[model samples]
Target: MLIHLAYTLTGDRRCAELQRMDSERLDMSGYAYYENIWGGGAESMFRRKASVVQHLDRLRVGEHSLFEIDDFIVNGGEGPGQQDEHRRLFAPAVDLNFRRFEQDRRAYLEGGAERQADEEAALMRWLPHCRRKLFFEWNAPELVNRLIPFLYLDTYLSLLRAERSTIEQVRRDLVLGLNRAFSHLYLTDSDNLYVTTQYLHSAEQPRPLVRLTIPLSGVDLFVDGRPDMAYDRERPDLLLRFAPPPALALRPGAPMPKLERWRLNLLTFEYLMRLAHGGTYNILADECELSVRALKDQLLSAFAYEPAEAGLIEFFVAERRRYVLKKIQIDEQGHLRSGG
Candidate 1:
């Protein structure tokens, strides 16, 4: 269905052909639905609160539970016509809680270099490959953007676990103790709800200017529903946010809006890391089919760094390391740093 939708949207023949050939090339039953690895049984911290993360495709309307698709469709919502399924697609919005990282927050804020390193190290323990460049850089290439939601989720999950929330609460609410490969769990009500966090520049100061954005694709609620002959695509892509929980008052004043870098919209940072490690620049430029100068421009654009600003990062990707990209980190002084 998604492949067909992609084809419909992009009018890409390749997407259409892939949908047509799906049965022959892919195992639908084994992979059609992602397992509820990030959720506990019903009664978790979310809307249902069943004490576990449940993955059944059931909906509860007040006291009555609706499971069958036809029945759900038959029931009418506040909207005219058969909009039960549409209305069932969402629920009341709720605020997300993440006020659990204050100690580490203070460490990162009050402590100096060692504290910053310790904080980052703690975060890495949860999602090791979470590259730092994504947050610090201006913007990202498209592929990287797709992973931003998952990465940010991990950042918070790390904090939640580090704070030692209850085993069950962490298991269910924080989405731990599960075989989840990715980090988001979409619920019927999740579309209406968004995650938010707050921090202080100091104990009394609110860090309001640093707008931490969850780079998300546009969402359009289809009132008319699509031609699938059943119902509408209900869920929105998972949206999330992670605060550096940095101090507000000391933050530098910048009149110009800064570009964000947490999405997959940038080139592989590993390319530059490779270059930095002594790979030939001209040779790599040739392999990627661009002149050294043109490649350099793209590289500069990827890093959002210019040598004059000391943000410029130079690198070399050895032949064997072509696909390897490194993570980008920002130091307290805003200098770019890379490791692991």
Candidate 2:
């Protein structure tokens, strides 16, 4: 029926041939009905085929006619208008089947079923490649866009067996992973834009400015000087800030570490503080070649790592500063005593 319909909609000889071939292959008795309806008169068949081919070329997977085909199967060929009734019948079955398949696959993998795991992984990988080709050939941007949401979903699913972590922690990791990937693609100096001639001109221009008001908590912490302010919400707020570079721009591959490196240094300091205290702070400062005051200011502002904290934070800052001073031999070299 679908083949005949496709043939009728598209006067494509290929579609008509496919209908005939499938009908013969299936050995269905209904082939006669299709022939009588569509293969009778030359003008009727030609006109119908032309119309059907044109329509079929425009057919999208989720559009109205698609559901009609599914409905036809579910309701045993009662046809178009009965879609609403059959949809209710089929929807639950499809959902249940998908859920069961996922559960069974997970259970098999958990039980060390290597063969099943390999098979499932192979099938999953094949599906995306097939989908990409279909979407590209059909020029279906909507279907392609639908696939984008799954990139993160798939990333999370891939990490399902990793060390158990709280949902909040996992969510944070996912956000960081996505941010890293996006930054690499869109913001990195060696990104695709730099290599492509078409994008090189655009790359030379500064990225468009984005304005974001600091959160009340952030404002209270920095502007109001409240170090005790902690976020109570499960999700951390993301703030994007921009610092326009100096007019004497550094060339590509320059040694300058930029703001991202500063942010990373602050995070590293916070992590180290959580792990230990009473270490020589001078070591860290010297390693990064940062003055004590500059390092302190950067850590405080970038990560909210307060030196006033009683235990880990204060101990960490003091020890790190001492370590920096000693390692660089700042007293003998007189390097740390002077400004850069």
**Candidates in order: C-alpha RMSD to true structure:** 26.0, 20.7
Q: Which tens-of-lDDT digit does each residue in 225-279 have in candidate 1? A: 1244345444222111222212222346723223212211111122222333333
TM-scores, all candidates, are 0.16, 0.18
Cα lDDT tens digits for candidate 2, 71-178: 233232365544453344334222223234334334444546556766566444323323333333334344343433222333233233332343334333322222
Q: Model 2 — which ten-residue stretch has the worst lDDT?
A: 188-197
Error of 2 at 311 (Å): 40
Flag regions of model 2 displaced more than 4 Å: 1-13, 25-244, 247-340
lDDT of 1: 0.27
lDDT of each: 0.27, 0.30
Q: How well does candidate 1 match the true structure in TM-score terms?
A: 0.16
